[model samples]
Target: MKSIRIDRNRRLRDDPGTGHNRWHPDIEPLIEVAPGEEVLLETRDAADGQVKPHMTFADLAKNDKKVGHPLTGPVFVKGAEPGDILEVEFVDMTPQPYGWTVIRPGVGFLREVFDAEFLAHWHVDGKFARSPQIPGVRIPEGIFMGTAGVAPSHEQMRSWNARETELVSRGGLALLPDPQDAIPASQPIASEGLRTMPPRENGGNADIKQLTRGSKLQLPVSVSGALFSTGDAHYAQGDSECCITAIEMGATAVVRFNLLKGEAVRRKTRFPRFSHPGYFAAPEWAAPHNFVATTGFPIREDGTQECEDLTLAARNAVLEMIALLGERGFSREQAYVICSLAVDLRISNVVDLPNVCVSALLPEAIFER
Candidate 1:
């Protein structure tokens, strides 16, 4: 039951051997902890070491894009081998006093239309966050990771690359080796810099807010020792995460790791699953406030919704939200933050043919009169 803590002083590339941001099988381990030991991890925000409280959009534009989801740790667990279940239990999370939400050009679900970059800053206080600039908007704090998981294996890498490449050849979205326009060859995981931008089977970037304090995420080990790393902490976020960025904040996650040894308990988990000590059924973070819902249909009767894309559908929902908030005199940036923190997306009908509608729900309580 050794308790190990890693902060800004220690990271993957911050050390002599381990890599940074992107995931790979080869990054050296920083600590070797026994099974069922607790680990305290400190992480920088998604802006990698830049984008502080005083930074503007110009400062954000200057951030290095080399590291996709800048995080902490690759602690190698003792006696843990491949195919074992690495139970990452959430003991608690300590977030920084400030947080941010961004809308970058050509990113997120509505890239084409919302092309201009925008930024909104918040005063985070563990329980709630609100921006003085935005006015009358209160975001209830719900801390959970935007990215967390074990590094990928060689076989998993192949599978990932093959699938993404196949999709790209057919004009699908590209996401494998992060879209860094110029990645250095000497950078660790450079040649094989598997982006942590999208979620994968290895559990990278699993942005489910249901992974709050009372839950444990069971990730199947791919490589030896279950080289685990985590970052991209968000104070709160909606389901669709249409804006790309959530309430991005730097937080410390105190996690207890356990190795489910032998062939018995390991058989219970195939994909990543959760174990909650709380109630029977927990929705992704409690939203007790009544919400105004809007339905978005991603089709226009003659197949003009562009390949029936889910991205288009999600964006349509967000657009409807923007319109509603605009009618109430909220700026688009304010509306975007409202969407990230206060809105939730639900699929109304995906099998209805020629039209899939995603409903975006805006919690009425966030608006202060």
Candidate 2:
């Protein structure tokens, strides 16, 4: 299999030729591969190696957020073109021995309530992720790439920028284009390149944990050669990465690409789609043989209700789960981290108008008896 390797000690910016941190059609491809060829990519952690295992949460403020997702490649699939479908089959994933999860202030699902920074350093094996910072819990390994995508066409980039600019004007949250710490550090590409945080039609940072080994992700191509790139490996993560992170780590991903000519155009697919062959996680953890579930409605603590707000419902469910964990002797910070690493958030009801119900399920099997 062909591969692109990088030094774990160095950042992707230090060797930009190996990878890039932004999404633009003109970034150029590092290597070319035909359909059905398996390629191995060595990826940096989501923070681009900025948050090391040795560092505590106190050091998080020094890291550059702009250099967040350092993706491995824009591998030129030989015949891929716009409107084609790039099917990436994940064959295997190997995580580094150590991993981390962090809760930073001013971010995440409960950012308003969780303003304090917390961090957990984990010892990851093939089967589980165990952290000393949050004791008594083990997160089952459901290794997957948190970010993966094809570069957007120039038209898509311009259109996306215009729309996001409008959103920012309307007091919405959007990470606009900034060149300060861009990897390629080129001229107009650096200044105009789209940020990798939002998953677009080209599928950037869609942090779905179910894209594990044996899963296939189909990305709608928008540029010549597909310019496919990936990074932000996760050892394990819950359905809702409520804390803004999972067991984040550097990992080597083995994937095989197959081009479906004009498939995206034929189906008018504009977003990424994925399918897993068997269980995405070990069966026991996937279905949770023994689970503790906390249900929440759109009702807030002040007795105010959100009309069919699924986001608020999810937030309430997670908060309730955290409180339950606190009752079991865990600190609020530790409970939040636990929720991020292992709590699965499920929508129990949405058809009930004016009130949505969400459930946060914590697998009891994760805790040692």
Candidate 3:
């Protein structure tokens, strides 16, 4: 049982499938680790070395591939058999001395509205990143990986597709059968390409905020050794990640892996959900709001009703704002898109509301701060 320490300066390559970049921990010349052991990797930011402190927008224009989101590895887990679950526990994410986030004209969730290159840089002069928006809002600097996951059970998937394209659901590890299995296990399971941001069973681009430090993620093991890789580090991101990118940055991660065999796991394609037993905290326009969050699980098989109802409830909550915006002349489509992109749906006050007053946070940076 040996340990591997992968450094941040290791050479990385672009992942053609995801249009993101990555590195394999096991193949690194400087680090070596055996199965059932652990590895520590010092990672780089999302710009993949393209953006460094003191580098200007002109420098960013010089690099063909902006290399900020560099993934650490396709670390091979020795003896990890199919039908097993690889448990990855995130230990710590200490931010580099600095980080950056940009809003490009043609990119981001609101590209149509803000069609201009907007770059924001933050350096940890001491303890926080100064916020340009609110002179009083200073954020404690923290680093967390934005993208992390294992190889697909079958062939590599295409970028821009959802993580669920060829693999299982989001968050949970995949369970890939060996090629020797009667079902021809190595074949790609689905035809969908890869997802742009959301996480899938193959665990790519999962932007779940709870995947932070002190959380355990279980991935299904499909092939021998479970070729696992992780990348897409973020400094801080709000829920729904309305911005195309978080405070994208690199990170060093200490990961511990364990195997679970034949456990009865649930297979659902919905986004990950969490529960707060007592009262939970949420932001309010005028006051601090507390609510008991609860969700209504739709009985319909297709989930159309559930999605529709959830969308309507979201609209209703902002009816006054919508009317005001419309009165000021914003179109219905624009208002709807605003809600869709900026709003986050959560179970709220399940015990009190008739249909479970699902809480939707609308672009509040309160959580990130």
Candidate 4:
């Protein structure tokens, strides 16, 4: 099996040749392999080791946001080309000992309300992740990569930039291309590379927990050789990742690649599709036997309602869960992190116009009482 290893004690910046922090077609592949070849890749944490177990919120201010989601490899898969489908089979994942969840300012779904910075340091074992900061709570292991994707073609990159730039001009929340702290920090690649925050046609940062071991993710290929990279492993995460983080950690992921010639074009696939043969999480957690749920609607706090707004409904659902946790003696920050790590948001009803209902379900089994 082919592999790429990195020094865990050092940041990705210290050895930029092994990985990259941005997505650009021109960034050369770290290695090339034939189709159906299996590869093992060791990856850095999402924050590139800037957030440590001993660190507090004070350290967050000094973090370099540009270095977020430092991916391990743009492994070139031979025979994969534009209009083909690249199937990534996640064979296994080995989680590191330490993991963390954070609530940073100007990030997450509830960024406006939970503006304060908070951190939860976890001791991750084989089966569960227990946090010293969150007393009496234990999150079950559901290891998976948080970000994985292929290099976008030059035309795709330019088109994406243009659309995002237009969104920014209209007061949308989009991170534009910035070369500062960028890996492979050379020439136009640094200035034009796409950020790793959102999922696009190339499938970066989908954060789907269901893509665990035995799962296969099919991505629409847009570039030759399908230069694929992956990183930002998570020990566990809620569906919404409401607080914008899970049990974030560095991990070694074992994956194999397969190609479906002309399948993407034949199916008109524009987004990633994934499937898992078995349960993605612990049996009890996957379909929780005991749970508490909160329901929310599009109606705002001021008695006004938006027209079929699922986003507002989800926000309200999570806020309600936070309030419920507060009644159980958890601080707002603690509750937010808990929601991020354990809560599952489901749309109960979307056909109900002007009042789409969303439910936030908290599995009671996670509490170690």
Candidate 5:
């Protein structure tokens, strides 16, 4: 029944942080609370509050991109430990009055297609996010935290970073910079923050738009006290998140924490799960501009993609979307815009290779009714 104020005492690794994009057990808890309590959580934008209302891509490019997605906790829940389920119910999430999206060179699903730098700004009111920058576009309010997680144990950090290092060494990752080159000699490798780019077991940037208010996110505790923190607020986002950026904004949420134990303490390869209880109406899910899309992988019972790639998965989904648009007699540009604004792309499963399906829930509603 206590409140944790979101302030300076919560800062950790990254620029304003002690180091890089990592969360470690050593970072000291900013506040402590027992399970089954509510706290009003405040957060900065994914760019760590760097891009202002009047700022342009040039302004953002000058500022350090490393320090953003500034998370706001390490909130120690009394009696929480590893193998426990940390359930966070987002009672509410409210975005700020402004937001922006950036498409930088060498980033996004279609990076090769559009290699230049682009920025778009939006005016976010209490209800909708509209852009004068992109006339005739209005996005509905479905604000959610793009990143949230508890700290991993030291062993987890080494294993995670080591795997990434292995990938870089094997040239499996082309865009990722070498970690060794990025981290200084003085900082402890285990102490640095985990990269906030990809989704991991500890849940950094899991950008599922369905995880809005009324959604409960269950994460496995790798470290004691379940040092939970969150940032990367998005006012709205398509499923593919193809552009590498969403409508980023600073926001606040009232989170109610609960501990799930017994058989509920399961970790899906370290990835967390988001669920909405009860049969609540989801008009948006089937709205005209939207339709439940299925991405076909057609993998054999015993086959593999042979590559660690979501880009390829996105390609399949986009191709499916293009086909869907063709059915409606829409052009490529029309389909692309609809995908940007309405399509919610989600990986159905990557485990079942050959047919690792990716679903692009098409918002048929994107087209005129």
Candidate 6:
């Protein structure tokens, strides 16, 4: 098996359509690899290595477009045939000695209320940071690449948020079936093309907090040569990722690839498990919630079942406020948007019952505070 290291040497000038600036990886085209081969990638942080010790918010404001989440690669996996799964096991991500997390104006869950941009800088004494908010809170700092995925399967597929303005010109397949499964089989399926901001079946910007260390992401191979890329390395982010940015910092990631051919797996599963033997302190603010799982059965063009018991399970915890608010006073649409801004989505159990159980947790404070 051959191993390659990928990096992003330049910044992307194109608009990511999310009103944020994005950077593409500056690396050679990916070299194809046989099954079981691995690629170790050295990923950059969201700033594209621009943040400095003496930098101020003025520096950030000047380059606001270039400061948001950035990603690397369009690495083409060799011999990776369609109908296969590309497994990315994150071996390690080492953060720089310093990092920054900022909340920008008109961005984040509290965007309308808190319109001013706030910056929180930190110095990593060890693998952690002393919380700049409160004295006792210890911040476990680790690098997590925010944006990572392959290119679309077809030409017409624009970035996720660009659908309304751009016509579906050429071939483009929606990874997620709409209310109905009306996607075409012959069309190219780029999992990244489905969701507007991360968190798709192909695992684009799944800002899951649990993806910190020792997590494995398994993405389906839609087109040949699973084009894999990763960037937007964050140091620490809350569950909801309510803020537009996390502790944005530079990162070096080692990725190992494994091919799962003809394996029976659910559409969504908790990222591969990591075992930490040492005991760790749980944040006082953290609370547990029940798990709710839903299965999406593939429907034929005629609305009949194509395969029996073949279901995709999505696990998410509904916030009591959002659920109760919708049930009582607020409209479902309003409640859903509130939940999207406040609720946290996570994978609970991949091997449970007939379907996998994904967890979505809601912080009680969002409602109380």
What is the lDDT, from 0 to 100, of the residue 111 in candidate 2? Answer: 94
All candidates' lDDT scores? 0.74, 0.89, 0.48, 0.91, 0.68, 0.49
- Candidate 2 per-residue C-alpha lDDT over 1-369 given as tens digits, one digit per residue, 9 for 90 to 100: 799999988888888888998999999898899999999999999988887778987788788869978999989999998889999999999998888988878989999999877889999756888988978888888889999999998999999999999999999999999998997899899999998988898888888888888989999988889999999999888888999999999999999999899999999997899998786355666678689999988888899977989988999999999999999999999999989888999999899978889999998988965
After superposition, the stretches of candidate 1 with alpha carbons farther than 4 Å from their true spots are 1-19, 175-188, 262-270, 275-285, 301-312, 351-356
The lDDT ranking, best first, is 4, 2, 1, 5, 6, 3
The pairs that clash in candidate 1 are: none
Q: Estimate each model's TM-score.
A: 0.86, 0.97, 0.61, 0.97, 0.79, 0.58
Displacement of the residue 293 alpha carbon in candidate 4, Å = 0.6
Q: Provide the RMSD of all predictions against the true structure, rounded to 1 decimal.
A: 3.5, 1.2, 9.7, 1.2, 5.5, 11.6
lDDT score for candidate 5 against the true structure: 0.68
1-369 per-residue lDDT for model 4 (tens digits): 899899988898898888999999999998898888899999999999888878887888888878988999899999999999999999999999998998888889998897777889999766899988899998988889999999999999999999999999999988889999988899898899998888898999989988888889999999989999999999988899999999999999999999999999999998899988787354666667699999999888899969889999999999999999999999999999999999999999989787889999999989989
Q: Considering every candidate listed, which one attains the maximal lDDT? A: 4
Distance (Å) between predicted and true CA of 105, model 4?
2.4
Q: Please list the residue runs of candidate 5 whose C-alpha ends up more than 4 Å from where it truly belongs after superposition.
A: 4-21, 174-191, 262-270, 278-280, 285-313, 319-341, 346-369
Per-residue lDDT of candidate 3, residues 81-121 (tens digit): 66666777676666666666555556544445455454556
lDDT of 6: 0.49
User: What are the per-residue Cα lDDT tens digits for candidate 5 across 133-178?
Assistant: 5555567776889988888888887788788878889877522323
Lowest summed lDDT window (length 10), candidate 2: 280-289
Look at candidate 4 and tell me the lDDT of residue 63.
86
lDDT of 1 at 12: 32
| C-alpha lDDT (0 to 100) for residue 30 of candidate 2 | 88
